[model samples]
Target: MDVQIVHEIFFMASLIFFGGMVGGAIAQKFELPDVVLYLLVGILLGPYGMNVLNVANGSLTVKLILTVGTSFILYLGGREVKIRVIKRVWVTIFLLSTIGVLISTFIVGYTSHLLLGIPFSIALLLGAIISPTDPATLVPIFKQYKIKKKVAQTVSSESAFNDAVGSVLFFTFLNVITSGHLSLEHSFVLFLKDTSFGIGIGLLIGIFGTVLISQSDYGFLKNFSPIMSIFVAITSYLVAESLGGSGFMASFVSGMVCGNKVYIGMKCNLENRKVQETVNETTGLILRMMIFIVLGTMIDFNIIFNHFWINLFIIFIFMFVARPLTIFTSTLPDGRADWHWNEMLFMCWVRETGVMPAALTGMLMGMNIPYLSHIVGIAFMTIIITLLVQATTTNIVADKLGLIDK
Candidate 1:
């Protein structure tokens, strides 16, 4: 890369980071999730608003920022889903993330095909692209709100795990579109391959991380607990991807293991957990801000507005019809979870389309695939609409549903 490009990169990074901090401040003052403001800040600095930074969509810098930022955030999300709590709802979580994503994809796909006249395969691809709810968006909202434990954990955990399912389905369908083959058995095998390796690798690394820093006799590296968390996250993610697994799943699984050291039978005498937490908090903040800001800058208003009515109508079905059907169908059958209507309703309202979908669309941006512009437009619009509507109203809805913890 040339010096000018390098300089531009640093300059853009600085603006994004600084803008994030400011957005965070404003978010706090109004008691809102910071993601909304981070996106707005990005729009402010991006080509549409100020014509400041014309950072090309799917550029290396954009990809790199999103890749690193989302992985770390996902790891943090995994940490929040305690094994003890998850066990009670494991079946629900599993079905919700896996089968639930598939269900969602089909609902949105068929609905869009009939309504917008989009080709069935392309519509299915669109559904797959947006099926996974974003954990980066959820974790912060959970932290800010005091939703009931079961509801919160289920939603957050679903967001973390479904990214794997969503990705596999997207690729599988993409293959279908290109090659005109839809193999159910192949899809199942592919999903298994990615998740198994991802969780397997994560388990090994999480165990390794725990032993390295646990206050056990062998924990010579205990002093660097904070730094080790970073090492663990990045290593798990890269290793899983290297092995053709879901890197996001690996990161989340590793995070779960790291957070609950007792589950791993480690005598974590790490007295510096507080400091480790501080580091993670700061790091997550920076990442969350950058992810959304970059998403903001990537928007193409011309395409978005060109198909404004059709895209908006699709989003309407996406948020309401498809999501509710998917959630109720997935959750109601899990007799073990015995979900309350309100809790299920809260889960229904809280599925914010965010970083995962944004990243998937970004990956597709460079391709000359049919309906690519529509895909990009709808995906980004989903991000904006969900963040603005569902995310912002979370507290109010939680309070209304009486799902709040307090």
Candidate 2:
């Protein structure tokens, strides 16, 4: 609220703005993911390097900004999913989001416990927190590679839906670990309550928001549709959480409904028109630019070195083993046998993580939880490697495998 703080925020905003533009160009030239560039810029200008932005200690302003940005990013992620893909792959998505995620959590946790000497409970928490892939990176990479729709849908849908499941898993374990009395029965019941209620509320909000946009008489409202989506995402998340539901899930599902219903389907009469697609593409470009730039600026290099070898091992194994195993086994039964070996390999390594896991790490740390730093370290490292390495090379791999769309 201070004038000095306002000035600083503006200055940082401008810095991020320009930095994003330059980073984007660099990303395009180097065939890197724009998000990596954003994070790089953040690291350079943020307190970690040049000290141009002081969001290090977590100021209220910084938290608020990040929360808003993340909600919008998640909402936009939901907006990309269409109902058609949902119908065709609902079973796969459900299995992957719930059962697949649970399996990954257990595997990663047990592996960590054995290797890192952490308590079983804390290891499980770390596994749960890091299980779900971030859609921000997944979505872009899938689009870039021009993979088959079903394969893309599988990865994208899993990432979007599993975030909620992963979050629930994290909180469920946290409650059991922190609170005095939590039985498995209680945890199961809570999971049902949170998942169902979040979906219900998200559906209601999405329906209303879509209706409002569909029937609005004002011209200005159409121009500001992106802004309206921000509000819808926040309201859905908060309302779902207040009612003992998963805010993350609700926001995701609700945004999916709104996007497919209002933006991609019947309400979007102009969707097939060039202008509409252009606007949508522009919005995506600008958002991706800003998100990556800010992400880059938020990196703490100190965390990276502190957990270097251990974190690298986790990222490597997950990309090489954990994710591919999950996808290959889960998708095999669904008739994906025609996919080439290289195509299958490319599909295996599409993992990503972002703001949510990073923030959860800090929250756990504040609660005096052990292994919080390690989880955060892993989260940052995974994002860097996944987005920069996986995202950038996905297309090349796909091309080599002849999986690129003709």
Candidate 3:
């Protein structure tokens, strides 16, 4: 590693830590999502503002930051998914995460091709890029504003699941777009094989983590209960990815099991639970800080301006048209969870584009994908607009929909 880059690694990390803490305070005071402010703080500190935090957009440094931040955020997002609640609405969650993403991809894809005159393949790439709702953004907002439990859990779980699926979908398209050798059969096989391996790894490791921290005679790591979940979280992701699985799903499932320790036979004593919450919250807050701020710092406004007006219009369609279409299509069919119109509507407005898209954008940039400027510009705008409009308005939307907890 270059000496200057090492200095940069330390310097940027310090800035994000201090800057994120201060921005967090501001978010709490004004009742804004922490991610929105973290992004602004980054913009203020980056090339566009102070010009001090000038890091190359697709440099190794940015990629490193995103990799750590993305997985950790997924870990935290997974913790939000309680298995008990999941059992009731698993059908709805499944449809929303899998089939819902597909619906969103085509809707936005065709719309992009028609309006921008891009090929359908490249346009679908855009759709896949922005397909998943961001758990990094959604998890915190739901945590801050108490919405109806079922609604919050469902949205949070969907974000985590779809993030994994969206990632698989993105790379699948990348192979087709770049290599020009498309195979539906191969794609289908890869999807199943990867997702299944991911789930298997997560459940297996999560069970181990749980047993290790249990109050049984064999529970050796009970004293290290606080960090055991972390162990499971990181270990599962690495193991799953190593074995050709979704690391995102691994982290999430591990989190889900660790969170509901009782489901996995771990006794949730008060002291243990308290310590786990503190560590999780602190870690999650910092990861959110690093991910979004780094993302904001990397937004090259010049690229974003190439199709500024049209990008805004496309994002507008994504949030209003495609999102609602997805929500209705996925959730309306599930007869298991008695659905309400307002709750479904609330789900529509809450899907913000954040970490995963930014992470995927970073990967795309590193690959020097065609239409680099256009795809990134649209993605950046999606992050900004969705965070501004949907994230900022989360409380009001939930309140209006009568979904906020009393």
Candidate 4:
């Protein structure tokens, strides 16, 4: 509306487009994940580095972009999930996403509280914030390395599911910490409602979307099928959120339904498939670039440096101790899916935090929670370390484990 605001918007858009193009290309040339390049570019141009692109942390615009961008990433991740695979391994995925997240959260939370002398509430909040693995970071590794199909699917699906779980947990704990009034019973009810309603809305819309695409064969309808899928994703997310549901879960389910059923129905139409893949990939790339770049801009070196040792300690514990404990415990029960030691180890190490944690940290900062700086510093460090360590080394791990395709 205001002239300055319009100019700022235009400037940010231009920077993201041109910067992403250059950074993405360079990352590909070096065989690195584009996320790394995007983040570095963000830091270089952002307030922390050059002060060239002054996007304020926790601003309304940043929050909106993150919300939409993360929803899109989750939807894309879900679309790649195969229903057949889920049926066979749903128990494993469920245990990994839910029980696994809880275990990681408590382990990290209790340790932080005891070691750092922070309140148990704040420590729990931190644990919840960083618990979920990011699908956006892992998708590239899976695609680039041609990792074993089952392993990739498990990781991707678990990432998507746990993001929703982690988000719900984060907000629940945030409310408990801030207000100190919510009962466990009430929180459980809220969790149930969020999950169930989200699934309901997603299934309904997904079915509607599938029918919409499948029953239409007009040239214009076929041409716009990809756009239509995106429309469904955004609409489903908004609708679910407005009704007090988990928008992330809803968008994921909608995308999964549309991708597997509706998209598959068009198998006979090669042109349609190509158009869908091209458009979806392009859109996903742009969103990821924008998200990571914005994430880079939010980092404050002062906070990170102030708590450097603790941050490093947290990352080490999360990667080496907490994650392994959760994965091993969750998969140990009888009748759970049996996985090889290599697969289990790979799963433990694939715990990279990404956009969701960044978004949650921004939201918490906006809330002005106590010990905010420490929480944010730990989160930022966890993200950087995990991406640097886990994401970059995924292919190597797969190769060592003989999980990479020949």
Candidate 4 similarity to native, TM-score? 0.94
lDDT, residue 378, candidate 2? 71
> What TM-score do all the candidates reach, one by one?
0.94, 0.87, 0.95, 0.94
Each candidate structure's count of clashing pairs: 2, 10, 0, 0
Candidate 4: residue pairs that collide: none
lDDT per residue, candidate 4, 337-360, as tens digits? 667889888888788899889878
List the global CA lDDT of all models: 0.84, 0.71, 0.84, 0.82
List pairs with backbone clashes in candidate 3.
none
- Regarding lDDT, does 2 or 3 come out ahead? 3
lDDT tens readout by residue for model 1, 1-406: 6999889988888888888899989999999889899999988989889877667887888788777877788788778878888888898888888778878888888877887788988998999888899887787788788788888899988998787668667767776777776677866677678778889999999889878887877788888988988898899999999999878778888998888887767776546787888899888888888889988888888988977998898889878887888788788888988888999888889889888887778877777788788788888888999999999999999999998788
Off by over 4 Å in 2: 180-182, 215-224, 262-266, 269-298, 336-342, 362-365
Q: Which 10 successive residues of model 2 have the least lDDT summed?
A: 268-277
lDDT per residue (tens digit) for residues 194-274 in model 3: 788888998899888888878877688877877886788888988998998877778877777777877656785678778
TM-score preference between candidates 1 and 4, better one:
1
Query: How many collisions between residues are there in candidate 2?
Result: 10
Q: What clash count does candidate 1 reach?
A: 2
**What alpha-carbon RMSD in Å does predicted model 1 have with respect to the real structure?**
1.9
